[model samples]
Target: MQSVDVAYAEEWKMDHGIMVPLHFLTPRYDMDIIPVNINCQGPPLTPLNRVWEFGKALRRACDSVPEKIAVIGTGGISHWPATPNSVKIVEEWDRDYLDKWLANDKEALLAYTDEDTLKDAGQGGFEIRTLTAISGLCEGKKGDLWFYEPIPIFSVGCTVGVMEV
Candidate 1:
């Protein structure tokens, strides 16, 4: 997990590098103790365009390590998690996001720093960064849109899916 907070605290953008893997600190996920790449470069607060480098680094790790790796990038398709956006949801953007994922459109996927993502989609939409990176990691692989729903409780356009090599 690349400590984006720590890295950001030092005023650095996470370009390309893997951070120490941490044990599932909390019960949020039931993932194994194995290393999980945590790319925090794109958070709800300040999202950076580190997608290209971030994905490359993960690809490198997957190839270098002897263990089988399954990289799962999780985040909202759109919808800001805080502020005035807490009550809003962008189903259109979410659907389009899933569409791009299912189609494996890397170019379009990495090209979403538009005002819609922040202004309309809300700050939470920044989470798309992780999804963006994952798609890059699984370039040329087949991915399925397992499920998608915009839950109002959390005010996020949630997506559950898989990308298989």
Candidate 2:
């Protein structure tokens, strides 16, 4: 397993190489893959159990592929509850979460609910997707912190990091 902090999808692809079994997973709220649902109110709240199901599916996909199971988690720094220093706080939380994640413990990762998470870091709730991705990758195995870098811009924050299982 290997890890790298990156910003752009092209950069990640360039580094990891083409032809990898890539799985781009993002929070439905922040996800730009499909048309943005502007009519939808706040970001969609994902049921914890539903996320677990998706994790299981991801694991099955990796098993089927058997190699080059590259999972990319995108988005960070929530945008609700409006507060100062939210970006920094979110970055810190993300770092700590990754630290625990590397240890292969889902309890710590899954303990926080979407509401609590959003209230804690405002827009940083966006980071939840990253946590979910890490959880899926770790899959009960120790995740080694490979990289961590937080970028704050436009009153928002974006953190890019990776871990190896």
Candidate 3:
């Protein structure tokens, strides 16, 4: 095992066109917890500027690749009501969140953060970051959310979206 600093440094070099370390937890490694600029806390973490940079990178990468890209977004449609009325509860707030997401509004992107909301929404909630990543590539385009399914047995929310350029 390597220290976090050593591992992180190796990972940092990958951003500058170097071969990523074998153990780095990137998409290639079947891990998806990517570090956002906000979490970097470094000199390069200017919010809007960084977002633009990410947008450019995503666009370039997607254009460079010839494979069809599937943009999936997960989470939401959860309400922790004090009284359990029924097994299924519809959440208008969550629908509004999805609306803003499909609209590709960056401001709306940053507002949907609550650990409780994520937990209550379940596994698919982890997919929100996927939406955020796709948003960078689809900044000014119209997106369609084609699927929204809640699996109460697993306490998970799943959604699939497509971005039109």
Candidate 4:
């Protein structure tokens, strides 16, 4: 096991990233939740390769416990949010990413550099870290893309998927 320092939030606010999905999946809001956030928006961001390793480590940690756990990774696919190109939705880029993600192609997924993501998919594409982590957790397992649509109004490609773990 890798020795890494884990930080805890003293005060937590349920951001839309977690709340929107939970609002649909757990309407009752009774179940416990542990939110994991990847630094997709800031400098010194975690590298894609390290993100994959983190996901693998997380899987091992979850497996060490007896309780049933469900991990949900939520994020926008390819859209330029809060920028002059906010209306832009890179459908081609999103589709290509979804293709690799569904196949759990680690090589393809990790091949993305921040510069490439920024150039092709815009800043919002950084959120793929969360989805890529899910891919890592389900390494060697394929996933299903249940729904994916570019919702210009929302400025994101609304996506829902599940990976076999």
Best by TM-score: 4
Q: Candidate 2 lDDT, tens digit per residue, 81-116?
A: 245663354567666666766675677766767667
Candidate 1 to truth, TM: 0.71
lDDT minimum window of 10 residues, candidate 4: 1-10
The C-alpha stretches of model 4 lying farther than 4 A from their native spots are 1-5
Residues 87-159, candidate 4: write the lDDT tens digits.
8899999999999999999999999999988889988899999999899888999999899999888889899
Estimate, for each residue in 1-165, the C-alpha lDDT of model 3 and write its tens digit. Answer: 121111243345333111232243243766433332222222322243344345546567557778764333222345332225324434454566578778888777755554544455432333345456567667787779887765554343345567776
lDDT of each: 0.64, 0.50, 0.48, 0.89
Residue 153, model 1: lDDT of: 86
Candidate 1: what lDDT?
0.64
Reference-based TM-score of each model: 0.71, 0.57, 0.49, 0.95
Best by lDDT: 4
**Per-residue lDDT tens digits of candidate 1, residues 78-153?**
6656566575888987888888877768777877774667676776676777777777777777679877877888
Off by over 4 Å in 2: 1-43, 77-89, 154-160
lDDT of 4 at 133: 88
Which of the two candidates, 2 or 4, achieves a greater lDDT against the reference? 4
Q: What is the lDDT of residue 8 in candidate 2?
A: 26
